[model samples]
Target: MGLFSKDIKTMDDLFVHTLKDIYYAENQILKALPDMIEKATDGGLKQGLQAHLGETKNHVVRLEQVFKMHGAKAEGVACPAIDGIIEETNEIAGEIDDKKGLDAALIAAGQAVEHYEMTRYGTLIAWARQLGRADCANILEQNLKEEKAADAKLTALAERGINAKAA
Candidate 1:
């Protein structure tokens, strides 16, 4: 038997896998956040991630809704992609000893996560629409907007706050 030979033979399987994918991603982010918070020295960046942590919790709730809307149990796969991102961030954080430098690293890491989420959200929104669940797409759009905003905020912080401080 082939590895992963169980057929994704139904829409339900696709929906559940997607839900699991995002759930794993979000959960990994939640776990990584405290370290980011601890590493950040920029007052604004630290505060920003803190705020996003709350928003991220809401994101989990939103994903749960997507799962429920499809009548599927919310769960997650290992999500090697996000796990690797988190690992990379941790490595960078460990390498940088300066608090402000760490802050910059944290911002960079947060942006990486935001970019990943943006990609997933974009895909999920399109899939939701294709599946004839405009309502699901609409709900997902909220999280997508938030991810984009988080990325934008991180950029602004890097330019206006952290990078300047680092320099």
Candidate 2:
């Protein structure tokens, strides 16, 4: 259902819809990360992306758990936002020939993905609490914490030398 679908008439419905949105996004990120890991030129960048791939897998599991806890079907809805971000990342990565530049681009793309995840997780956590699903929120907080750490690692890699190497 669309975000504004008439089917979602209650706040709980909105919460579940967003939960599915992130579920779909995390799965998409899982699909995209291996290619990003392969394309990464820097060893550190490659390693970080690989590690996060593992975490992203856990994220999908956690989201499934949340769905079960909330008594909702464990499934995903189409998330156009994540689709656009992944598409943009692929287009940019394909255009860059320089290894250093590609590494830098990869970091940016990873951050874009992280930022999107952070927002969704944050919203879901809040909504979970509001809906009296503290159990679900606690589990989701784990995913959010890891996403923040991943984002920070990407920034550190960029600032430490990746961007300068590209320059």
Candidate 3:
């Protein structure tokens, strides 16, 4: 169903729909990371992307747990937002020939993905709590915390030397 589909008649439905959205997004990230890891020229950036790939797996599992806890079918909806971000990243990465510049671009791409995730997770947490699903909210908080940390790490890598190297 679409975001504004009549199928989502209640707040709970919206929560479940969002859960599915993130579930799909995480899986997509899981698929995209290996390529990013391969493309990254900087050791630190590569390692960070690799680490996040592992965390993304866990995030998917946690989302499944939340689904079970909430008695919703574990599934995903099409997330155009993530798809667009990944496509943009790939397009940008392909255009940059310099390794250092590519590294910098990768970091920016990673941050874009993280920011999208952070927004979704934050909204999901609030919705989960409103639906009286604190347990789900708490589990989602774990994902949010990791996303925030990942974004910070990307920022740190950019500031530390990647951007300078690119320049």
Candidate 4:
């Protein structure tokens, strides 16, 4: 069955569905990052992608814990937003030929993904708490924190490093 296949018949259902969406997003990111890392020629950019890949693995674990806490199965609903973002990243990466400029594009793309994840995780944390799953909220909060950190790191890379090189 699909996420919307069933009516959002309960608060728990809504919560689980959002969890599943982000779970799918996180998994998609894991698949996309290797190419991002390989295409990123800057040492710092490569390292940053590697670090976020580790964090994304942790995000999957946290989502699983949230499901366990809520007595739901840890499954993914397709997230078209993430799929589009990954596709756009691939298109942009394919177009950029200069090594330094490509690194800049990669950083910009990475930050966009990070910003999207932060929003989803933030909303999920609020929903988890509203559903009276504080334990699940805690897990969601952990992912949110990591997402925020990744955003900050990407912002920094864009600000003083990659963007300058792209110019």
The local lDDT score (0 to 100) that residue 50 gets in candidate 3 is 95
lDDT of 2 by residue, 78-115 (tens): 99999999999999999999999999999999999999
Residue 133 of model 3, lDDT score: 89
Give each model a TM-score: 0.92, 0.99, 0.99, 0.94
| Model 4: per-residue Cα lDDT over 1-167, one tens digit each | 56566667887777778888899999999999999999988888789899999999999988888788778898998998899999999999999888889998898788889888988888888887887778888888888888888888888888876888788
Alpha-carbon shift of residue 29 in model 1 (angstroms): 0.8
The list of candidate 4 runs beyond 4 A from truth reads 1-6
Per-candidate local distance difference test: 0.84, 0.96, 0.96, 0.87
* Clashes within 3 Å, all models in order: 0, 0, 0, 0
Q: Ten residues in a row with the worst lDDT in model 1?
A: 1-10
- Residue-by-residue lDDT tens digits, candidate 1, 30-86: 988987887777788889999999999999999999888878788887778889899
TM-score result, candidate 4: 0.94
Q: How many backbone clashes does candidate 4 have?
A: 0
Clashing pairs in 3: none
